[model samples]
Target: MRVLVVGGEATIGRHVSAELRRRGHVVVTAGRSSGDVRVDVRHRDSVADMYREIGGVDAVVAPAAHGTTDRLQTLSRDELLQNMQGKLLGQVDLVLLGQHHAAAGASFTLTSGIFADEPWPGVTGGAMINAALHAFVRSAALELPRGMRVNVVSPTMVGDSVDSFSSTFPGMRPVPMDALVTGYLSVIEGERTGEVVRAYG
Candidate 1:
């Protein structure tokens, strides 16, 4: 399988990329940083260029997005729109544009966080964007063509990055990065679509 993983330099993205490669699939990573493909999902032209460069892929997983932790009252219009543009509309457009670029039966897995339903204060942007993303995935699943499958991975705050925001999640399960990798694999390899695989409690 030729897999294109967006945001491949991030901690979870790196782990998922490595896991896919270990399974003997050829992995091509893309991000704003070092990658075979470079595209800021926030820009439509950049994303289109990325697909052109990669030509066709068996699967495309976007584990990259921009989200912020700010109280709703404190968030500026810029901050709120930034989250909506990148986390919600960015992936939505990616699917719309990428449909023609992916091979028949190709899979697309998007990233969301557990904050969608398990909300926390100061994370209103993340929570709203996450919920919208899941809804987008469910709708896209029904409309996508050519046997293409679309799903979202709503992972909890990962253990590796727990130090950054561990306090935000008091009793929530902090999933190991490895366990999240399995969820991505399930989306890619399984017969299911139109699903949000919650990789944590």
Candidate 2:
């Protein structure tokens, strides 16, 4: 499979991309500042341009999502919009625009996190968008054409990055990187659509 992984250089993205490549898949990585191609999902034009540059692929995996983490009350209007554009609308547009560029039977694997269900403080915007993605996948899968499939991977905080996020997700058990990647593999290789492939408890 020719897989295009956006944000393939990030902590989690690298692991997912590497595992896919190790499995004998053709992985083409893209990101804001890194990867084989440059794409900032926050903008629709960038995503559209990215599809044109790549032409076609069997799969598009996004392990990247950008958003603000401030408290809902303290988060300014600009910050709220930034969060929506980055995490919510960005991936939403990625799938919406990518549908036209996808090959027959192509698949899209989007990234959401555990916050959707278990919201910690200061994750209002991210949590809302993550939950919205679940509904988006459930509905979009029914309408996408040419046998295209879409699923969102909702992963837990990775053990590798536990130190960085332990404060935000206090007392929670961080999932191992190996186990988290299975969420992507399930949707990428299995016959599942409109599903939220949870990567941890």
To one decimal, what is the Cα RMSD in angstroms of model 2 from the true structure? 1.2
TM-score of 2: 0.96
Task: Kindly give the stretch of ten consecutive residues in candidate 2 with the minimal lDDT sum.
Answer: 64-73
Clashes of 1: 0
- Per-residue lDDT tens digits for candidate 2, residues 1-201, read 899888889987898899999999999989889899999888999999999999899998888675557876677778777878878888998899999998889998988888899968888878888999999999999999999999999887888988887887788888888888888888987779999988874
TM-score per prediction, in order, is: 0.95, 0.96
Residue 7's C-alpha lDDT in candidate 1? 88
Encode model 1's per-residue lDDT on 120-144: one tens digit a residue. 8788888888999999899999989
What local lDDT score does residue 94 receive in model 2, on the 0 to 100 scale? 81
Worst 10 residues of 1 by lDDT: 164-173
